[model samples]
Target: MSAQSTATERRRIAISALARELDGSNPASSAARLSEMLDTPRQMIVSADIDGLVSAAMLASVAPSWNVVGLVASSSKWLLHPSVSNEPPAGLVAVDLFSLNHDSISNHVVKYGAKRPMLLNLRAEWQAWDAAVAVAAQKRLFAVPSIWAGTQGCYDDAAKADSSKWKYPLGTAQILLALLEAADRPPKFFDRHYLPWLVANCDGGVSTYTKYAANARVWWAVMAGAVGPASLTEQVFRLVDGMRPHDFLDTVNALDRERQASGLDPWLNDDWNLANSQATTIERCLRWLADLTGWRDPLLGGIDSFAGWVEKPVKASGAVYIGGANVTTKSTEAAAVASLQGARSALNANFYHGGFSGSRFNWIGGW
Candidate 1:
């Protein structure tokens, strides 16, 4: 078949699947939830060539609202932008980061750059936030402050008492400090706690799943080469796994049967359950498939590393020699020296800042 014909067929299938999902029994559930209800075999339903489908616009953004939820709730927002732009625009383009990848961000900076390009990051960990800030700083890009709530102790009342307060855990505080250091200019930094206030007072609508998925698609597309195919698949699988419930699959199948039997195209069908499920399912499937197939990762890359960094040594120093004689130095020595140095630095830094000396090392110093 010709490429055009194949594209048409694929879209028909997508439309059929979506129609089935919308015709399900529930009116309140989203597509991700409906798919769980239908017991749609994940492997069977999930397009094997997801990246290609996304690129060709066979699957597109269904809602902007849900995308927003996924972005704000997750720990890593790095991939959010591309996910947004998976579908081609129907009308005038809006302000969004989904179509831009790291390289694209660079190109934009080189081309038509804004004073502060909005950066929507979902990293909940302090270190990840810091790393993102560091990159932003290196590029001299302005950050549109976003809520990253996934970090440990991130939601503490004291940590969130003031928007500017540094009372958060070391990792969280470090990220803020990094942002300040990088921008060489302080842009507004808001934690998750401060987000409700910011959004309530701001003029724009909140981010939604549809918007997030669209942007996420864009993000994945832009970073396709960087993330590779395997890694992308794993990420997509994780995304689907995270969003899908057990009942969604069964619900979708039942709904689809109903729609076809009624001679209704799901998107245009009057059935409330079918419409709702179809919309929800399409959105969830598109988002998951985009992430899984667009980016690739080698399997050998340690899955445990997804948890974040550890101080594992790359190589042992073989042996140490003292006075021309080999002397065995305990492996714990390195750890001890690091701890002692860290403590000393904390004390000295705290004294210089006129804060309580013990506060800096509270978790480590046993104070």
Candidate 2:
């Protein structure tokens, strides 16, 4: 289905009605009803990984007029990102970027206080942080879904605690899905986009799937037309399990298989940043995956590996480096670099429940 970049006055009225039905008090409930199909067209920036590609693709599938403009590593990375511009990028949207503000997110430690989680037109309201910060907010942005009640014991309260009872870095795609589904824009042919929902809905896909499900249900899920090969996500996980799952290396094999099975181009080969980033993206992806899964395994009654102290060697590469700072590696230290872009107070990102970047195509900003 082709989605035009238009929403009727009645449509906008309808969209608004559902979200603030009550104040934006609860994120999951609020996000489920969130829709930013405003009259304004958006230029979106997303992460450079396979998930970002999928998030962009799914969003395009629904919000056709919104442009999938650029890519970055995490949401805060975009604040000082060269892409942060002075004008024309009127409606900036960020998708699939990790937004949790804490680094070294160990046990249920509230290293920071929490932001009152609420819903907003993430598509319409997002903005860059014009300042340096060790950790950007929005992690645990959504309260845990009740389905995974087991986590309630640790998550005790989302409104006041910044530390997570448990953390899983996947599932932005799923949270996006829940948004569309709630907005009366229910998706179709999404079963083929198996990775989003499966990695999100399934128990092991994320931690405390129930309590965490409440967290934007992700950074967020959208059902593309099909779950072409839901198993592919897991297979891709295992394929890159021991290695860095960067630049869609995990997906390359899966997409290649799909290409051989069907003649489609797998959609990712043409990604704006994929070609240049493949060099270093994989190694970084694998290492992060390894670190996360390593600690997660022991928590889930699996074998202990390195007791979580095995730090991977660090190197500077665009995949992890953002604006001269390492955002992912030594995550806690990857603060937003002070901007040379003058004293423009960054806009308050209206849509950041959990969300939205790629390449230096001279692609400094996302206009």
TM-score for each of the candidates = 0.18, 0.38
lDDT of 2 by residue, 270-337 (tens): 22123333414423332333332221211111112112211221111112112223222233222212
**lDDT of candidate model 1 versus the reference:** 0.23
lDDT of 1 by residue, 1-367 (tens): 2323333333333233223322224342122232232222110001112121222121112211111101111111111122222322221111111111111100001111111212212111223423443453343222112212111122211223211111111111112212222222222222222222221111111122123342223222222222234432223323332443432333345545755796754531221111232223334433333343332211111122222312121111111111112211354335423432343211011101113221111101100
Q: Cα lDDT of all candidates, in order? A: 0.23, 0.31
Error of 1 at 341 (Å): 21
Most TM-score-accurate candidate = 2
Task: Per model, state how many residue pairs clash.
Answer: 75, 56
lDDT of 2 at 104: 10
Worst 10 residues of 2 by lDDT: 102-111
How many backbone clashes can be found in candidate 1? Answer: 75
Which candidate number would show the highest lDDT if scored against the true structure? 2
